[model samples]
Target: MQNNKKVIVGISGGVDSSVCALMLKSAGFDVQGVFMKNWTNSAPNIECTTEKDFADAEAVCDQIGIPLHQANFSGDYWDRVFKKFLSDHNEGLTPNPDILCNKEIKFRAFLDYCLEIGADYIATGHYVRVDNSGSSARLLRGIDPTKDQSYFLHQVTGKDLAKSLFPLGELTKEQVRQIAKDNKLITAGKKDSVGICFIGKNKYNDFIANFLGKDPGAILDEEGNELGVHDGLMYFTLGQRQGIGLGGIKGKEQDSWYVAHKDTQSKALTVVQGRDHPLLFSDGCYVEDVQWVNENNQEELNCEVQIRYQSQPVKAQLKKLTNGYKIIFASPQLAVTPGQSAVIYQGDDCLGGSVIKDRISSDFYSWADNRGYNYQVYG
Candidate 1:
């Protein structure tokens, strides 16, 4: 038992965090629950779930016989996370708001609060393991591969890793649910929250349209042929297969038209029909704005690369570029979309990662050769 160690656990009123607080408390640590209030204002007709979450957290704290504190971080969330998300989308890039929230709000502001309250450590329900040894700290993937969240946490620094604790890293989702059930926790049967935090269950397109004006654009097939019109170029992402309305080309032909490119200049969405071999694959990509948790200079490091959260880790050769780094995959990858993050890892340990700037492959530019097709063919 860790006797007399003061630990502050960030409780989101979810089963994972609630279990984390219970685990820490059972271990004899002086664990206090803190619910982070990050959103100040609410959107029209949208219910703010913060009150429910707070009440649930307070119930858990009472059940576990601990004190609960509330920290309001509305200003930081807007200025640091939400604003950057808007700017990144406006500039035609996919941004991960969760990463920014972890970097700026949760770790930075919450850690400050922990220090102010004379806590020795800050804990969360994140499904990532933290290891501190050999003169430094390391972050590793959780035991459950499906529920592992190390990809979104690559931005955490070594300093943050040292003082952080993850109680749910060794458990699977089922195990966490069982723990909550055994303890009769309020969030035992709660459905997992999806999409952006604070925004609740609102559709992504609807949320973006509130800040980013509706600038509809033409959806062009490969060879600059117009297939249909899209709601907005910014709303659609690379390699999107669904939601593009093309008449009569349903079943097989419509399935062929996967988004291959986005022309920001013309505000056009470019797609390729049929199983086009060349345009569907990429060797790897160039990633910029890299951050490393283990090493200061990521000049020489070999690690597995994860292009997206759901993507499997692939073997790659990493080389530091002027701004970031270039990753060459062992096998050809499909739809290495720009605006997504490319997180690198060594075994279970996450080294660092960067945002995807551009894709580099021999077959990526082959679609531009066919220029004879009419832009109004599908219109």
Candidate 2:
């Protein structure tokens, strides 16, 4: 069964990666395990888990009979991903750092390191499949749709994916755990990592505040009535229902409040009544930093778009603009926040994605020149 093909699997102290290494080794391919250290800092009173994660990764490699190599990419992560993330928040935008991490740290930095060390290919535990049948590799969603990670990986090019192997892509979370258990791996029951990689389970706003200091602002309604004050515009995102601190007001306490607008220029936090308020939805939006998996020449193509990671892909059209691309949803979409990504798909293939920049319109979003409405421009 020895193929003599050297593959480096990214072992992250998780059940998925542990099984990935086990399978690669079982298949007789020369396998090695790499533990990439991306984050080294922690918020106040929050325990640093990087040490334990590295130890766990090492243990899993030992169990799988592979040499575990540690590579510290903390500097690369901060410069390439974290700085831009902080900048996006300062501009009142909800940025996704994971996408940047995958593009900059995981695939670029770590992949390069793996190759320099004489690896034939780099593999990971990401729940995504690469179809290399075509001239250009096609990134397909993992069979288990619930665990598919193609959305976050939409920015990665087909070329990088072609050189990558996703062992967990063909297996469900249950099967992965079973394999780990059968092999007696240490990460058999490890909890999945959530939130930002550096922050762990710490309060998001609190952790962010440690980097971006406070900038007090006003909380207003659609009618320009001041309801409350905000610690900073960076603390909240559009459509966020919690942390607004308007739960126990005088008379309007019964009504639900959602973030409708964040104006960094005016230093304002606009809240709208009801979860499904008219001001929350948008018809379309312009996108920047578009990255396509395959070379797509068509300017206008009917496709599906996922505005956020968890949201279902909606019917949309990708229109190439003079300046950039735009996504026109078949129906009004809610909370298509700026700085978030909108991934395009054709059938099961994730074509590409881009960062949302501006919304075309929302029914009542255009008030006077703009302040509160169903339609407003993204920050």
Candidate 3:
């Protein structure tokens, strides 16, 4: 690789990105490390570890003999990612802020910033590969099936994918750590960060309640019988078993409860006793804001769809809609929550994805309506 193009690698102070910087430098490219502070712990009691991460990033850059750059995208994150996350939860939906952060902050804001400083490409530690061998770039699943992240990156355009590099795409977790260890990078054995991106580890409910204030509500059974009281609807999600503050009910076989539905009109949460409750499963979902990485990819066809991260892809039939698309799964999916993304894939290539606006199941919707619980209009 004989090139003098400048590449800005987004280092997250983790083993994957550390190896990214090392590999790019070894490949004879002009490499620099950029730490994007997309979130700050400005809120009372919210922990912010960006400073520590920056220090780790600085250490890796020093070891790699490259310059380190800093950029704070908290403003963009708040407006684009955080606000929508809160809004979705408040409206009885589960939103994946990480997906939005990748599209808005990492690729958009961070990419632009890197380009402004004369970068030819922006790279990250994401476990997804980009195929620029074609006329237009294509996003493919990482060689590591257990860690492929193409689902989260479905919304990124082909143009952006062309200019981005994923140095860790072909390597597994173990390989990444080994490379980092060989190079004596500080993050070689560092534990991976979890929870929301940029937002340090904290109690999820407490963090969310701080923004969407607790609106206490009643927990009801499938028949609308009052079971118990909940702190807030925002704290719950479909198929959630913990934190319900409920116990085994009479004549219910002493089984645990799961959140089946949320009646936003009456501020009532419906619970059922079984883990695989019928109400929790849906045949398909209506999606909005659909974006295709390559427009030439199939618009409507049979493919595999994934509704959440760490979920297994299932066979599905996708049909085009005026505003978006509808995915009809071969089998019912559990907890197909709105506000989360439904990404489409054909074999290993990620076609694209969109936000889940509403889940479609005639039986469930009709049952709720008959019981006087109102769900959003089915698309």
Candidate 4:
């Protein structure tokens, strides 16, 4: 009954992970609960809830009659995940810290620690399934489409996949919550954590300002007309329609405005009139730091790529580059922001993904080509 195999489940003091521990214990595995303390630094306007999470994790472990292990990965997280997150934003790119956390913290640090303690494998409540029937493990989208987390996990290496488990992969959010409720787990009704990894419920603007103070700049229109002033260029991202703080500008329509692009050279945030503005769509994109999962190391292949989590996968042609790959979308993609992951997949198989380095917009391409503008310079 696999009772001899020790499985260390990372308990995050949430319903999903709480239920994950319950399911693993019920399955007769030698289950142990581990609470990863990845963030401990104090920041103004940001609440550090590690103590509360630790207590909840402890209560769950006690209820399950399993020993709970705790480790401080704050140093490793700062070095590997938090630094890169700040660096990406500093470079005017919107980075996904969750992707880095999964790779560096949960899968790398936590996995290594568990293995060192004689655990056969480490599991999380990530809603993604792994297929080990083949010679190499394959990552698949969770059965619950609404909650599938494979996009964030595409950076995980093949070797790590083999030693990982996802007990809630086949269960929906409702099912996991129901299981927790049935077991009377303290986290049965706890809301899922969102926003920055480990820094709970912190406002993005305040968090960024606390770490890296604002570099205020002008908000401009597509034609280079200044509409208003912004706190910083790094504070906004592509496709953002809110927080522009501009209204009733003369000569401009009352329609909603969205962030179309950023001119880092001039320190300007460009705005378009509407959500479907041509500047928001891209025909293709350039990706960097790709990691393949199924050993598909081909130079080029046809696949579907997801630009962000919860987005529908779009058909694309993958052209391998020395450092990354060129993703030419069959159809124009919306809001393909730099530094966010471009996860490639063929059906349900998560081939791999990389950071979106650049994108080719037909509107921008033509506008630049006719004017003989250099793409590199414009980028």
Candidate order, TM-score descending: 3, 4, 2, 1
TM-score of each: 0.93, 0.96, 0.96, 0.96
Residues 1-379 of candidate 1: C-alpha lDDT, one tens digit per residue: 8867899999998888999999999999989989999987556656578888999999988988889999999898999999988888877787888888998988898898888879999999999998887688899999999999999889999898889999899999999999999999888998888777866877777777778877778887665656688877778777767666665653335445677777776778887765445676788888885888866665756779999896999999988776677888988888887788999998998988898888876655544445422221000
Worst 10 residues of 2 by lDDT: 370-379
Look at candidate 3 and give me any clashing residue pairs.
none
Residue 59 lDDT, candidate 3, scale 0-100: 92
Query: Which candidate's lDDT is highest?
Result: 3
Judged by lDDT against the true structure, how good is candidate 4? 0.86
lDDT of 4 by residue, 175-210 (tens): 998898888988998888886766577778777788
Candidate 1 residue-wise lDDT at 241: 72
Worst 10 residues of 3 by lDDT: 370-379
Worst 10 residues of 1 by lDDT: 370-379
Which segments of candidate 4 are over 4 A away from where they belong?
Answer: 368-374, 377-379
Error of 2 at 361 (Å): 2.1
Alpha-carbon lDDT, every model:
0.82, 0.86, 0.87, 0.86
Model 2: how far is 137 from its true place, Å? 0.9
lDDT, residue 342, model 4: 94
CA error at residue 328 for candidate 1, angstroms:
0.8
The residue-by-residue lDDT of candidate 2 on 303-342, one tens digit each, is: 9999998688899998887777888899999998988999
Clashing pairs for model 1 are 226-375
lDDT of 4 at 80: 97
Clashing pairs in 2: 362-374, 362-375, 364-373, 364-374, 365-373, 365-374, 365-375
Better-scoring candidate (lDDT), 1 or 4 = 4
